[model samples]
Every structure is written in structure tokens, then in C-alpha cells.
Target: MNSFEHDVAVQATNDDAQTTKVNAVERGYYEDPFVRYFARKGSRKSPLINRGTWVRVQAVYDSVDRFLEIYRESSCRQIVSLGSGFDSLYFQLQKKSLFREGDRFLDVDYDSVISKKVEIIRTNHELRTALRADLTQLTNTCGARTDQYVLAGVDLRVVEDLKRVAEKVAGFSLEAPTLVICELVLIYMEPKHSDAVLNYLSSSFTELLLFNFEQVGPEDPFGKQMTKNIEARGSPLMGLSAYPSAQSQKERFQKLNFNKVAAISMLEYYSKCAESLQDNVKLRIRVFLVLELIRMVKLVQEMLIQLFPMVAQVCKRI
Candidate 1:
């Protein structure tokens, strides 16, 4: 496929993710009040899909929560969401009054995606009131700045574009204490582009916590099939083979001068992080399905995880 068509497919992954999130919520996996507004109504998904979505949401959410609580005392902190699709975490967190005055939440994505989101905010009462975003100055390219929120239609491959947006948006800065979230974002780009982006963030931030979620493990039978499936769908995992393991992903951040870095898989995260009876009870069905999938597929020659939940890490920049 051509670049434009490939980009459209890449953008559709946002819908795929949102659909999964909506299904997860409908299935009682988590509480996300704003996802419904963006996700189109869809039929309930399998226990496996719901649980997989829950793992992604829970891991990233936990990392963001930890960062906010740890730096709650700091002033004018920022949360920057790269390739932020229809995610509503900022609005949800804002409802709970988690962000103090001067703190900003910025969501950056492609122009087409951001345009639709901007229109949704303009038309939706809850969204407009929650963010208090004034869209009077909305442009063709899709960008709006408010006291506590920023929506920018950006091409993330260009570091200068991000720098420009950061320069323009309050609390979004290279030197500021920033939590950079990139969920399923990096795998779309070439390694050189993504590496440059990471290096820029690493070198510039006075304090940074990067939460990167993407595909990993492409050497095994399951991984090989997973890679083929993704590529056949038109949007290939361009950067997957380069950083195909958790250790490789961890080292990618550590080499960027991060002081603290750790990467964990979905299976490992479930084993270590799920503490309560409720969580276990809720997830038991999905766990059974996961093992069943292993048995059924012969786990591509062995019972193993194909795609990852993501590298849940504290990737703190020194």
C-alpha cells in the first residue's frame, strides 16, 4: 500500500483500540466514563479481547497515576499524549480534580483524527464543559489551546513540530516535568525516526517519565504470524523487529540516559501487579481463555504470548 493508504490504516488502529476499550468497559473490566462518546457502538467482544484491553489500559493508567502522585507537589506539571486517539483519560482525571491549577494535559495526533475530536468536543456538552475548551479559533490543521488542555494535530515524526507545539502550549516543554505517553505509536515509524524522537525527549527533559506501548517479540512462530497479520492489514509494525524483546526495549530507554527503567510483559504484569481478590475474580475468565488460546493454537509451537501488553516502565530521565 502507498503511504497515504498505510497512514489511513494506521489511523484505524485508533478505532480498533477504542472499540476494544468500549467493549472492556461494557464488559465491566474498568470504569471509563468518556470512552463511549468517541467509540462507535459495537457488539461485545470476547473475554480475551476485553481482558487484553484491560491490561493495556490498567498498565498505562497505573504508570500515569504513579507519576502524578509522585510529582503532585510540583508546579505546572504536564501530561503529553502522543498519537492520542480518542482517549479521554485527561477528562476523566480532571473530573476527579486530580490536576491542580496551571497543570496542562495535551493530546496530539494526526490532523484528521484531531479534527473529528475537536468537533466532538464542540458539540458534546460534557466534553466542552469538562475541558472548557474554546474552539472559536479552530483552524484547518486542528489545534486549540486552553488553560488546562491542548489539542494539536501534529506529525510526531518531525521533532521540530513537537517542539513547536510544546513551545506554544503552556506546561508542555522540553525541560518541564512531563509524562510522555505513546501507546501503539512507535511501532508505526522507522527505528531511526522513533530513536530520534526518544533521544530528543531524553536530552531535553529536566524530568520525564515515558510510557511506551508497542508490539514486541517477532522471532517465534506466534510472533511471526502476528507480524504477518498486522502487515497484511496494511499497517505493518515497522519498528517491531528492531526492538523485539522487553530487554531490548528497556535498553533503548536506558541508552537514552534514563535513570530508572524497567519493562514487563502482560503475563508478568498480571502475576505481579494484580493484588486484590476482585481483580483476580474479574480476570479469571480471561486468563482461562488466554491459556485455552495457547492450547488451541498450540501457541505457535509452544504456549507463549505473541503481542505484548506493553513495556510498563518508570523510564525516568536524569
Candidate 2:
């Protein structure tokens, strides 16, 4: 079935994301033991690609971590990942104990994607064991649930369908602190359709934190190239032009009646993430030492190249 927000080409992007994430993990940009299972073997990526992938991955992980920390005393909490495809967050959180008995982690996506994911979970012992999942009771169009986790197949544009799954099926608490993650999912649909979903979330949930990581600035040169490339693949980012920058995102959320809203470009987000880490004295010292060692190595290499050449000329003349 064709999803309102994610179609075939957009579905394929899941594998691309997986490959890119696995590449970043392999290169020590981050650590994700579960991502490799969802990704097929692929070629190595450039440092820029790795860093970008790391930024996106780390953003969601850190966001979830902070949310859990802030809402630790709450009786109920929920994390809803829109268009979650082969995402490893559930497994990661399970290991970290951040997503425990009282907190719900729901993954929503197209029926086909969830079906395949359920099938994979059935066969993959590691994934199945981690979630303690049973595929025998998979919903006809949705997916399975184990303990605090639920995977539902529902179109985001249809607010009623999403409401049914979230409220009745998945048992998401409306009064709970909720973290809604929509990474590169909404931009596939027209602004009207995406706005409907956004409106539904902003209004329905009492306490909500919606995190969206999406492409913006289709008019810029780099943005134009990105748009052209994705369009060539038969999936144009329709909402990109509507919400073309971080400021636009913030304004859009504010117009939706969100009390608190902030948006930053990917580079700015990366810098802020680095700055947050630098607050830790141990990490700051380690980073400083690493940089100093690199500087010393470069200096020694320079001396060997230039000074050694001059010394060889003098010895030959003697």
C-alpha cells in the first residue's frame, strides 16, 4: 500500500539511511550495534557523509536521552517515531534502560515496511530477543508489540488512523510527556498533508516535544543540487520549499500553538552538540590532548620532510 507521506522511492531511502548510518558507525563516528543488522554491506562513505549521518543519528539519540532524563519522575511517558523504518532506537534504549516498563516506544510507518520489519524481527534472534517480541500476533495492517514497544503501520496524513493506533491500540498516554520524532518523513508529502499531521500532534497531545530533521532551503545552490538529485530519483521533497529554513520551521511550530519552539541548521546543531559535550571536563581534556597530539605529529612530519632534505644535500657536498 502506498503511504500518504512515504512512497516506494521514499521507502528506499530507508536503506540508504541505514547504509550511511552503518558506515558512520563503522568509522567510529558513533556506536550502534543494531544498525548493521538492518544494513546490507555497502562501500565506505566520505568523511563529510559520515559526519552528517552522525549528526542526524546523534541528534535523535541525544534528544531522546534528554527527554527521558527530564521526565524521569513522570508516571507515564511516550516516544513516537514517525516513519520509523529499521530504526535501532528501541533496541538501543532497551540496552540503556532509558525506555523501561512504564515508558512506551511506538514506531509508525507504512504497512509494507512494518511487515518486512516484523518478518525480519521474527528471524533475527538478536532483534527478537532484545524486544522479547512474538510475531504470531502481528496486526493485519499494523505490527507487533512486546512489553513497552509497539510498531504500527499507519499513514500520518490520516489523523484518524494515527489517533486510533496511538490512543487505543498503542496505549499512548495523552497526559504523558511525549517525544515525537519525524526525521525526513514529512517533507515527502505536500505541505497541506504534512500540516494536518503536525496540527494533530500539536493539538492532541498535552505535553509534546516534536523533533523534525528535514531538508530545507531548496533555493540555495547546495539545496538545489539536493533537490535535483532526489527529484531525479522520482521523489521530490515537496514540503522543502514550504519550510525552507530553520526559522521557517520554528515559525511553523509556533503558528501551530507550540509554546516552546527552536530550530537550528544541521551545522549549528552539530556545533551545539559539540559544545554540550565540551561541558564535561573529562571529555574536554581528552579532546584537547587529541588535538595537541595531532598538531605535534604534523610538526614532526614537516620537519622530517624539509630538514631531512637539507641534511642530505650537506652530506653529499661533504
Q: What is the C-alpha RMSD of each candidate to the true structure, in Å?
A: 3.6, 14.4
lDDT against the true structure, per candidate, is 0.76, 0.73
TM-scores for all predictions: 0.87, 0.84
Q: For residues 57-153, what per-residue lDDT tens digits would candidate 1 score against the true structure? A: 8888887888889888888788888899989988888888888887878898998998888788888988888875565543444676666788888
Q: Which stretches of candidate 2 lie over 4 Å from their true place?
A: 1-6, 133-136, 275-318
Candidate 2 residue-wise lDDT, 51-103, digit = tens: 56766777788778878898899878899999999898999988776766688
Most accurate candidate by lDDT: 1
- Shift of residue 74 alpha carbon in model 1, Å: 0.5
